[model samples]
Target: MMDRPVGVIGAGRVGTALGLALVRAGYELVGVNARSEASRQRAADVLPGTPLRDVPTLAKSAGILLLSVTDDAIGSVAAELADGGLLQPGQIVLHVSGACGLAVLAPATEAGAVPLAVHPAMTFPGLPTDADNLAGLAYAVTTRPHDRPLAEELVRDVGGVPVWIADEDRTLYHAALVLGANNLITLLAAAMEALMAAGVPDPGFVLAPLVRASMENALRHGDQALTGPVRRADVGTIEAHLRALRDRAPHLLPAYLDFGLNTARRSRRAALNEAGRLDEVIALLEARSAEARDDIDR
Candidate 1:
């Protein structure tokens, strides 16, 4: 009736971070396995008293094994343990891959272990500390029926809110997260570059609050909070921006147009509840995009 000892495979940032977290959360650190001396050193530095072993050695004895290996390495590692005759029935096998679902752990399942993929929806900046990142984070827990509740409980044990994801939606869900997190950072960097090129005064100083406020307002009101030329669909201003961005950050032109079109679509939806010239506004944007295409073909 007691929880099994937790074993962590792969001494990467996520593995090491979660291992230390589990230690504080009262789970016994059974052991960790990694191929590199640096990896072992990292594990020892952060998680003292934890033994270092290879996959079979860790899987043979540890009741719960956390596979924090890279996605490509995941199947091979699990298969190695299965082929080596090291795994046993009913052991908790967990992997931290976001794109892969429970299927990636088929080797572990073949070895009679119950497989779970618990993906933490947060980035590890490879900093010395990742404990704070674990707090208030959401984890997607996917497992076989017999193993799902245990997976959820284990995620809860580590102070993560567990969300169930359909197997088919795993890739799409991760895609959406990447678009929101990574793409946001990419857009911000591009924005800064463009501002500096424009000779904007204290470009960073000017952009910091403006960008933050736009995001903050969007969070509060969703699409209803949209403003600026796109929301108003000011053909003149948008056309001017298109020209300037093409002259400055030509790479961002497509993104600007795509996101602008999406924003206009949202604004059009918002216009349904209020009295605004959203219809005419969209028509003008359509005209501009068409004209830009025609100019390009010329």
Candidate 2:
């Protein structure tokens, strides 16, 4: 199957990057199907010399079809190909949706195509260099037991390490990734916004080392790495923060309180010695949250 020609549908950031990686890995990219102008441009830029074809043509010409459409569009696209009799028997059909499993490609399976879910656990910024990030990344793959080897090989060809995920566990696996990666970005953005509001210049520069060290410590020590007023159970400091946020960054008050409450709970769980004071901190956060809600109502 490594020698089979590959075709990509919905040549967006991830699709184009993976296609480029496969092409570099010696797979013949027969064609691509990209609907929007931006996607078409991305495919042209990243997978230059690859022919742009329609869905039916791309599906028929390639021995392996990569359905890189949005999570919601995967099933519908697979059904369309199956309905049009575009998928051939023994052909490999895979999607790059972390949230979906082989079930989304049931239509292709019914058409005698092998279905696999191959999701790389990395973000793609749609740049030409996005393919470089694939190396050493973990790919969460879910497929039939018989197709496991094929899925692993495909992932390795794109420079990814295959991590077998159960079909039933795909949603939870993807949820964890979103919670870690996406929510981290949201948290950083909110923190930077608060810094700017406080008249700080070069917020990223100021936070870079601290954020890096905190992430490293958290990854290495888990909850034991937690610090700050929440961990210390400093109710006075927490109150001061709430007042400052309310005065200068009212929009951040709710998030600050919510995260503070969670941090206090985690600290309580981690340190029995701090549990008593942490309970007070939690109560303080909850009360502030309620007050913030009341202010919003007014």
Candidate 3:
């Protein structure tokens, strides 16, 4: 597989980053198929000297074809390549969708091509250092048992550690990533807004150390790291927070209530809080949520 050139079907952020990594790893990027101007420009900028070709041309020329398109578009793209008689026997076809499995590449499989799902469990922000982010990160790989060696080798070639994820578990695995990475951003943005509303000049600077410590603690100790008013059963502090959010950031009230209730439940489960006190916190959050809904209805 290393001897064969690799072709990228979609030159988006993830695609371009992966292509660049492979090139740096000494694999020849034979061609790229980028539809949008932005994607084309990204390919030209990152993968200099690589020809921008059409899908069929890429499929025909390269021995390994990477369909780094969106999760929803993988099947159609694979079908297109298969129907065009472009995917050849023994050719390798792979996708970078964390949510999708080998099913999306069934068309390519039917065309006698090897199908692999290699999802890098890292963000690619399309920066010059995006390729460096691939080093030591996990790649959720799903492929046939017979193709495991090739899949692992390919992941290692791009500086990723291959973690075998069953096809049936791909969606669930991806969901966990979204809940951790994507939702962390949403929660941080909300926190920063609330801090700014409270007259903090530099919300990020104020929260950075605290947030970093909290995350590190959570990662290291899991539920044992639960703290704050919810865990301590500081009902007065909880009520004050609800009142402050309701008065100053009305839109944040619902989320605040939800997170508070979840934190209380986690505390209760971890035995970090007295059962009765945690129940009081839960009740208070539920009541605030009900009141918010009533306001919305009115």
Worst 10 residues of 1 by lDDT: 272-281
Model 1 over residues 1-298: C-alpha lDDT tens digits?
0268888898877778877877778888878887788888778777877888767677766888888788898888788878888888988888888888877788889879898888889887645477667867899878877677887777787789999988788888889889878999988887877888888857779888998898899779788777788776577888799889878877667667767777777877767323256555566657756766776789
Q: Give Cα distance to truth, residue 230, candidate 3, Å.
A: 0.3
| Candidate 2 wrongly placed segments (more than 4 Å) | none
Backbone clashes in model 1, listed as residue pairs: none
Winner of 1 and 2 under lDDT: 2
Off by over 4 Å in 3: none
Judged by whole-model lDDT over C-alpha atoms, candidate 2 comes out at 0.89
What do the candidate models score in CA lDDT, each in turn? 0.79, 0.89, 0.90
Q: What is the per-residue lDDT of model 3 for residues 163-276, given as tens digits with 9 covering 90 to 100? A: 999999999999999988998898999999999999998999999999999999999999899889999999999889988998999998888888888889999998997899
Top candidate on lDDT is 3
TM-scores of the models, in the given order? 0.85, 0.97, 0.98
In order of TM-score, best first, we have: 3, 2, 1
